[model samples]
Target: MWWDIVKVLYIATRWPWPVEMGRQRMIVQTLEFAATLGEVHLLSFGDPPTKPAPDFISSSGMLEMSGLMGIAGSMLRRPLLPLQSHLFLNGPATAAVMEAAERIRPDVIVFDMARLSHLALAIHRHYPGIRLVLDMDDRLSKRYQRMLTNETAGDLGGTFEARLPGAIRFLVPRLKKLLLRVEKSLMDRSERRAADVFDAILMVSALEADEMRTDCPGRADVVAFPPLINELPVPQQDFSRSVRFVFIGNAGYAPNAEALELLDRAAVQVSKNTGSSDTDYCFQAAGKPLAHAVYKKVEVAGFVPDLSAFLAGNAVLVAPILQGTGIKTKIIDALEHSVPVITTPVGAEGLGLTEGEHFICVLGEDDLAQACLHIIRSPEARGGLARMAAAARNKGLTSQNRTILRDRLTFAFGL
Candidate 1:
């Protein structure tokens, strides 16, 4: 059969709208791209707008399950499932998925995240020979595992100790450890099941894909495709006064939250070392509210509608991501926007971005501060970094790279 004749159905746990997060944007981009190749249908749990698109099917809002009832049902039916899975694998969501699959009769079913991978078995049973593809973009299990390891190692920098009151800090670590342990156990089982069920498991990072493959020895082949950017912005030309650093992400997210804490610490040290007042340095945060503790130094620009425009206006994109799994999409976004970046080596993982060439890599708060100051002081350095980053983005991640990713997706499912 020709690839164009393949019917693809995408099932998502949440609505892929507004394109705020990396995973969400990936889902949206895939759907849009896939529609061009074949007949595509989207079924998701998030509430749809009043006038939803023809191709988009949303779960009926008929019965809003009571919180207690939902919890009780989850606990009874799926004792070992993670809380997220329990919330998603409900009656309404299942019904919606089945209805869409039946109506579409898709040859290929794409689960946007591991959360929806449980549906693969049921869909395959009903459809007999459907190709199941699991796009594990977020890598929830690996992210949580890293967090667990960090917590266990007593490296809880941006955890309960910082968030909660000192009075309860003693108990917070123990409670957190218990919760993470249980969640990790459940996720391990769930991820393994996902690997066993899906024909192809798509990951954003090669390291994560390898880890998944190791966990489920002879299951599906895990494929790694770095974060895809459909378009690239023209490189920023002007590098002017006032050293400005911008960080973009949902600040509520654990990894981003921790990274923000690091940024805050770095900002303080930078200011103190340079004898620069708050006015001399600007830490603009986009996508979510800045932390209250760093409110004085950081300016909160909640959810900028135009991310590219935001990056264009800023001097450098600072990504001090301490811990997370999978590729950092914001870093790619910055490079694509032609804005030089300052990120920890952890942030640059899996992107094939060189430290000195593409962006400056700094380790501790002190190093990060010095890096920022150096970039601010040196126009030649700033220009060179931006040029290198822009060139890399153009060569590595734009529409040209989409062909490679699209080919991989198609080949994986025998489209």
Candidate 2:
């Protein structure tokens, strides 16, 4: 760890106070990591938290946002900019950030995600010598491209929908594939723009870091930052009776919505394939649901407060993630909690874990039900695998990795 850190001005498109959801958590984690390097002052969009922060993490800055009309104004004025980049473009926001920058004279300005890449580029233009960074949590282009190929989408729920203007929000669910293709193309350009401009680019996956390096060689410093997990008590074990088959994720997310459907199909297959007449293994689900999707023989709990407690023993995290780009944070949660998991190669991507040794990895979607049966039938094996996975996962989170990450960030900032 460094003894000193550069004073940083961190910016985010989302208001990350009172972290409750997945994206919120990611934003907060990024802020916290930035703080580790030096004093941080945060600037973000979205309404300020109605409640006081939960005394977790914080920054002092005004909350500024672009209304629908304001965004439309930006689009008309800046015809050359991509349609999606307009979401974060605001004249008032730039003015406020410029005011803050002049006052603080920060060593580095960190922007979160490609949505803010252009904004960051503009900010860096005014202060050319200051190091600039883009903390892209996931490659949106890769995610959207996969969404198109798989044709997987659903209502992104109120939380995500609120970010869009009225017409875009209304049209998005109706025209999922078309909008995704557009977003995919625009994001591909945004990715390249960020790669070309920023002094450093932060990605959540190692493979993505290498890809970016190869695509734009010697353009910028690129490094992979592991997903930051909350420090919570390890979930208590409970391996008894019929194992609780579970799936966790925001169903508003297209990939997760598809995964829930896959879980249901696997459950149906289990009923038909099982010799017993009563193949009544009712599955449990935690997280938001789709706008309209029925869960057959599954107990759906929408957005549980205590996830670790809910994911108690006899609970197997079944993630049939057929599409998506970044590491599945939910799978990591299960591994950390010592909960057995049944997933596919896509589900287990990026996370350096062995196939059979860590978690049960199935080949095809059809093999999902059978994998669940295997985990259910062998209680001893499931427990052993979960324990081993947890051990290896924690073991990898060592000082050496931290030292390497610290060095990369430091070098990127030219410290």
Candidate 3:
């Protein structure tokens, strides 16, 4: 039988069974789909207490031991922990994976991220017959480099060249830039190696797929398989409350922190400008605390596990994100729950959503306030946006889309 012939192994950097963040959500969704094709085995780092999955063997103890080694390795290498993690945990993880492969004699192995591609390469090196699939969730190297640069730039207060007036400033900015470049180069090499060794590379978006093709050329087959959202029943809610805008995301992230800060200032100004003295007109912020000051006006609902129920009570979901890459899973989650979204251009990427029809897109503080005001005062407008969001969910999670993902997985693994 096809299932008998194809025993697939999935290797991930983090535990996937318990979907928490966007990456985990993608991992879980992919695993769910992959399970339907054949017998799926998962190997990941130690499971979090809050998040756990039912399938596969977990060898996370190795990762913990690797972390201890990473601290010792840091003395030799500047960023020793991260490097050691890549080397130690990945090496042992790969070894254990190979042993499993030898026992199970699986036809193929699916690596969930570029970080775990080390395992895929190891499998290819030992068992040359086994096909390997690389799941490129994001351009990790580029994303990290971008984050470092943005942080450095923010600290420098201006461009590197422009800020080099003081005696120490010249060397400081140059050193930071050089370090970032080196990090990017090293990660780029790892990514390239992973791409070259893998039989196929799967990405979450067309933009990301194009990037991988440009980087690795003909060495790997790159395809974009978007994350799927399971259709959940949304309870009817009263949209008659005073303008209460909701923003959902892990607030610990820098981009989200900045978005919440922007929303806080904008919301305060909007409330005052509109002459609305009602406290009911407020901003409800969900997720962990990023910045202390930003939590002042914003009502913090820390990490609501039951997101659908949380959305059921909220009026409109706001994603005022200014930066980040890939699709916003929060936006999709909100749309799936029939909650109207008002987001920035960056927040609404890759969803193929029409601005007004699907949700509102506001660029500036005033525009965001105005949009909130419109939605709050007009119940009909809010209802229309909610209906459009429900429609988007229907189109995104159709059976045809699931088949596309299944076919891609089958072909990639030669099942």
Specify the highest-TM-score model's number.
Answer: 2
- How many pairs of residues collide in model 1? 0
TM-score per candidate: 0.85, 0.87, 0.80
What are the per-residue Cα lDDT tens digits for candidate 2 across 146-263? 7677755444322557678787788777877776777777777778878778888877777778887877565778978766433346666655446678999878776787888888
**Clash-forming residue pairs, model 1:** none
Candidate 1 lDDT for residue 24 = 75
TM-score of candidate 2 to 2 decimals = 0.87
Off by over 4 Å in 3: 1-5, 47-52, 55-65, 68-91, 145-179, 277-280, 290-294, 364-366, 377-380, 398-401
TM-score of 3: 0.80
Residue ranges of candidate 2 with Cα displaced over 4 Å: 1-5, 51-58, 155-159, 229-240, 277-281, 363-365, 379-384, 391-408
Give the C-alpha miss distance for residue 117 in model 1, angstroms: 2.5
Clash pairs detected, candidate 2: 238-313
* Per-residue C-alpha lDDT of model 1 across residues 339-379, encoded as one tens digit per residue: 77788877887777777877788886778888877766666
TM-score (C-alpha) between model 1 and the true structure = 0.85
